[model samples]
Target: MENGSRISGDRRPQVGVAVFLLKSSSILLGRRLSSVGYGTFALPGGRLEFGESFEECARREVKEETGMDVVRVEILTVVNMVALDGPDPTHFVTIIARAEMADSGQSPANMEPDKCAGWAWYEWAQLPQPLFGPLEDLLKGGFNPFAASRLM
Candidate 1:
């Protein structure tokens, strides 16, 4: 792989979204309930639905998964993850964006707080682990909102 990046399995080409919602000095993170990365905490986002723009998808996903409306969206990083070990190798482009908070706080609707669990806003420098995969790198890289360059 170029740049020394590695893909572990046969995964299919898919487009996904990720949002880094910030309020006060913390960023929002949601625990996965349904998906390949279930039980792990990840940014609030999902696949882009047909006919929806990437930004729209990001906004909608954040609301659906965390109940917190997105006030503004800004692109932070783009991650391309690949898996080459299955029937059909997969490639995913995860567009990571920063979302400003629109409400005080909220939780997933109709889901058990302990199952879908609850979302948390943590200090950037003290984020908990098991934070999906791509996000872990972004969070650990000292990403600054005003920075011109993104971490590779």
Candidate 2:
């Protein structure tokens, strides 16, 4: 890990990460407080640091934001997010992954109150409205994170 040091190239598209933490039949979701996607539902992840792989980013972000340890970090898919609809166009090549808690009894907490309002589990079909940009694109593409039957 690069101690949360984000990548440098001025022109390189920023790398974002999100985790699909499924417990039983529900997946974890958090409401964003940051400017990029304020008040929208988002996965528990942050920017990938320099020299840090996507798996490391996911694990670290989950632990930091939810105070829970996760295992089985596997890449679900990648989304090329181009925010063309907004005035301030943004592009993030988000790497999405799936993970599970080490212990089922352990629940999530809002460790970073400034970045997220809180954490909760929601059914896939009943996800909250106004998801973060990358997540919105993922849902629109019909990318089901829980379905292990599909080949990514």
The number of the candidate with the highest lDDT is 2
21-139, model 2: which lDDT tens digit per residue? 99777889999998889999999998999999888999999999999999878887888876644445567898889988989899899999999999999988789988987888888
Give the range where candidate 1 is weakest over 10 consecutive residues by summed lDDT: 143-152
- Per-model lDDT: 0.69, 0.85
lDDT score for residue 86 of model 2: 46
**In candidate 1, what are the lDDT values of residues 67-141, reduced to their tens digit?**
667776777688777655444455678887776767655543523454456777778667776777667665567
Q: Which ten residues in a row have the lowest lDDT in candidate 2?
A: 1-10
* RMSD, one per candidate, in order: 5.1, 6.6
* Sequence-dependent TM-score of model 1: 0.73
